[model samples]
Target: MAADDVSVDDKVKRTRDLLSSFYSQDASQISPPSNTTSRFATLDTINTTSFDADQYMNLLVHKSNLEGLLQRHVEMAAEIKNLDTDLQIMKNNIVGMEVNMEQLLDKIMSVQSKSDGVNTLLFEKREHIEKLHRTRNLLRKVQDCKKASEEVMLVIVNKLEDKVSSDSESIQARAEAVMLLKQLDFPVEKLESKLLEKLEQFLEELDLSKDTSSDSANPHESINEGIESDSIPPRPEVPTREFVEAVHAYHVIFPDSEQHLVKLMHDLTTRHFEAAKQQIQEQVSSAKLSNRLRFIWTDVLSIDEVLPEAGLQDFAYEAARDVLKQYVTSLFSYLLHEISDALLQIQKDGIGEEYPLRAALEASKNALIQGSTKVLSDIRYLLDEDLGLVLKLRDMIISWVQEGFQTFFTQLNGQLLLLSGKDVPTDKVSSGLVLVISQLSVFIERDAISRITEEIGSSLLGGSYEYGSSAFYISMRTQRISVLLRKRLTTPNWIKHKEPREVHMFVDLFLQELGAVGSEVKQILPQGLTRRHSRTESNGSTSSSRSNQLRDNRSNTNRARSQLLETHLAKLFKQKMEIFTKIEHTQESVVMTIVKRCLKSLQEFVRLHTFNRSGFQQIQLDMQYLRITLKDNAEDEAAVEFLLDEVIVAAAERCVDPSPLEPAILDRLVQAKLAKTMDQEPVAS
Candidate 1:
């Protein structure tokens, strides 16, 4: 039993050790069941002769069960070891959760601090708002006080202004009275009583005048006549306080005080116009000069070609002299009247200031100044080359223009008098003056043509017809003036932004006249060469045979005459066409230049209007200064003079023929006539 027991115990110990090693777990160092091992060993080693198979089987079963138990214990130990690892991980997670809780608490504390700061700021802002409200209320009160103070100050200032004005007015009145006393020619002490005695006697006469009942006996007649006389020679009232007060009082009483002004203006215009007309009559020489003017047709008649080679210059000088003399006289007279009329109209229309009478005067002066030289030159060119005759004619034209220009400018000065409410009669001259000026250019052209004809060879004068060169010049001058007037009247600035429809009406009338002339030209032109005049043909059909041969010969002679007449007519027609072409070209050039100027003016107007409102007045003042400076420098005057010299002279030069044609055409005819005369002579006389 001891050996078997010991061996079994050792086996059990080993089995226990093996299980521990296999599972790698400590289970109180437990020993495997020794009883089972011992049983097994006893069964195997002991020669148990008596033991049966069943007993041996039982021992084996016991050992197997014991082994299974050891295996189960090892499995349980392994499960416990896994549970320990999970427990360690759970402890680590719990430690991390505790750290997170601390962090959360710190964040909560920080949030609390910010919230407290915001509350403090809100409290301060609310107090500040309350203060602002109080300050606004105070400002309102101050504003009310300021308004009241302003009203009181305004009233006080107004009262002081009125008092000061009254004092000044009184001082002015006293000064005027002292001046009147000083200017008095009569002794004041005796003058009053004597005037009073005369007045009393006049009153007595008035009282006794009621007795007469004749057709001309009116009680108020003498007073009316005195009033009329006063109107005729209206003098400015003395600068008395009474007169000033009356004007002021009248102005105050009638806010619209222009009625009296209108009437006064009308009377003044009438009176001044009459005075100007009288002045013109006294100054102007109404002499009927000889009509020595002749036409010099362009390319149709030439002074040089018609006269001998040596007499070319002399002939030209003579032709020009005769032509210009008649024209200059008429022109000067016409210009004087026209300018006078324009001046009167300016006063009548109350437009002297708007038109600027001084400027108009200057313009007229410049026109004359420029035209005078050219006129003189033309006159010299017309007269014979005797330097003395040429000089004489030149001097005459110059003198006439100078006189006319002076007279015209004088009218402007007189116009200013009319504007001052002195009765003037300027309106009556407008139409007549215009008509005279209108005739000037026509007369000039006609006179030139006629004079040229006289200078040409005798063969050139085929008929009683004469050229209307003077008439052309006058017509052109009239048209130019009309154009300028039309432009001045129609422009926006000219009327000071008040576009007068009447100006348009006037323009329309001018345009209508032009249209009628154009229509007349169209109507009078021949349709075709084949279209024979029925009237001429109708008068030419009846006669005898032998008488008819003589008639035929006469008819042939008449036919030849007709051919010559046709040649003359053709030359005249060509000259007229040339004149028309030259005029058209000149007019186009002038119009283009004028349009450019107009466009520039419009651009300037726009630029001026666009400047800031505050700058507008400054710009105007600057412009005025510039204008004054320019005038002082004589720059604009020089420019206008230059333009007048260049433009008008060039245009006029175009009007007159530089080379004429009638002499050349007539020379060929003369040569032919001479050759025919030589051939017609008998072979042997």
Candidate 2:
């Protein structure tokens, strides 16, 4: 109030006098506070009223000499300058406030002018409203709120429609639009349907793109045929950038459709793999199946890197795993189915008298090697390529690869694997799938696990190899080979034959099969360490399972052969011999098992049948030739010799009046046969 009482001219003059005294450079120019003549003013720590510049200067000099005096003088000057600055700032602030106040006043005046005009118009309207109908005005008032709400809904829908694009921005806009519509009590069914349509369109475009890609003269087919081909194949175009954009847009829009998204990824991957498979020429395609999948593995990893990771972070990996598993399943099924069909057709068409057992088996081996190679490659890629970040799915898939192959063999068609309980006729070439699968199992056990261990740069497949599925394959292959052997050697035709001629034809036929099995083993397995084996068969009462283990145990002569034991004795010629089993996947190991099992079958036949001297001498001739032949073919020549001698002993034991063949006569017969086999017809060259 007192400041308001002073005139502007007087205030300016008073301020000039105060500022002039501060800079006058005289000690007496400074003034002390008076507190407006009030009684409440009290002395504080600085003691301003008693403060003397010369006294403070003397105290500083006494404590710190000339530097302390000069420091104290500078501090006092700083305080004075700060006080002056505060006053100047306050004056400027007041001036700024005054300007703001004037602007506010101008705005108030403008508002007042508008209010006056509005009031004048309202007064005129009030006078006119008194003359209008009351009913129409009431109707207009009631409709106002409804019309406003509906118009707001329309505006939001239009904004949302504009945002329907293949981008994250569109997804965000759609979310906001849907939320607003829900808040405003509006139905969003149309917009949601539109979005669903976009999702389906994306999936369809992806599928169609994949389908179109396969409709051309692809060069990959020619590569396996040893022909030169270009890298670029004539195929349908793929939607590259659009595909990524579509993926980014749909995941957020349809977050709950995780299964749908997974299926979409699955379809894309499966289509890719199938196309790759179809690109290989069927004639030479077996060896290339694994190589194609290696490229697919790289592609899958790259896709995992590219796909949007929002809600579907693991979708690509899930798709790849599912696709890979199905692809493997398809490989087994196709190989089995193809071989089975060929055999059936061959039978139906009467192509051969016997299952071209050797060729049929060789085909199966080649197919399985490619399949195992494919699985191994996929495992290597998953573990070595950014495994930690690409989702912790590496081990899961690798385990599947390792375990799945083993389990698959257990389900193989029994008849195809030569497991038929009924008699398999000698003419039917037992399809070699059982043996191929067995060799495949050995491959995983001996070679695949080793390579996988090396590939991971770890210690031996992470740890010691679990028995896993290799054991099943080995057991099965053994069963099938045993079945194939007994079906021929122990048949009524072979056991009850009344012949006294050249060595039994079954020996040569059985040897041919062994050669084929050995050849296949060489292709798919490592050159395993040679193992020396010593085995003897025993005839005794036993359960079904006991017979399974006796392939590793012994036989007694006085024992009355029981159910399973009698079957075993007859299967192996009633002599001590190694049964068909899981041997190393090597040429020698596989062939030796077949030979031992075949010899065992011969021994059982000799013991079961009542043969005269002629039958005994015929058996003796075959045994002596095998003694020479098997020594070279068998893994352990000593075991072969011992087994061959036992077969003769079993025949002699079972013979009626077994007259021993003279040494000179036996040599002449064996030599004649050996020379027949050794002599080669002259070549045209």
> What are the lDDT figures for the candidates, one per model?
0.37, 0.52
Give lDDT tens digits, candidate 1, residues 35-124.
665754455432223446777666656665865556545744764575466567777987988898888888888888998898887988
Cα lDDT tens digits, model 2, 392-498, are 65566556655655555554445344532236664454344344445545654686546544442322144224322333434455566556646644564433446
Candidate 2 Cα misplacement greater than 4 A, ranges: 1-310, 315-320, 338-357, 368-371, 374-391, 412-685
Clashes of 2: 17
- CA lDDT, candidate 1, residue 649: 20
- If scored against the real structure, what TM-score would every candidate get? 0.14, 0.28
Provide the RMSD of all predictions against the true structure, rounded to 1 decimal.
38.6, 32.0
* Top of the candidates by TM-score: 2
Collision count for each candidate, in order:
62, 17
Candidate 1: what lDDT?
A: 0.37
Indicate the residue-level lDDT of 133 in model 2: 52
Candidate 2's error at 238, in angstroms?
6.6
Off by over 4 Å in 1: 1-320, 350-685
Please report, as a residue range, the 10-residue window in candidate 2 with the lowest summed lDDT. 37-46
Best by lDDT: 2
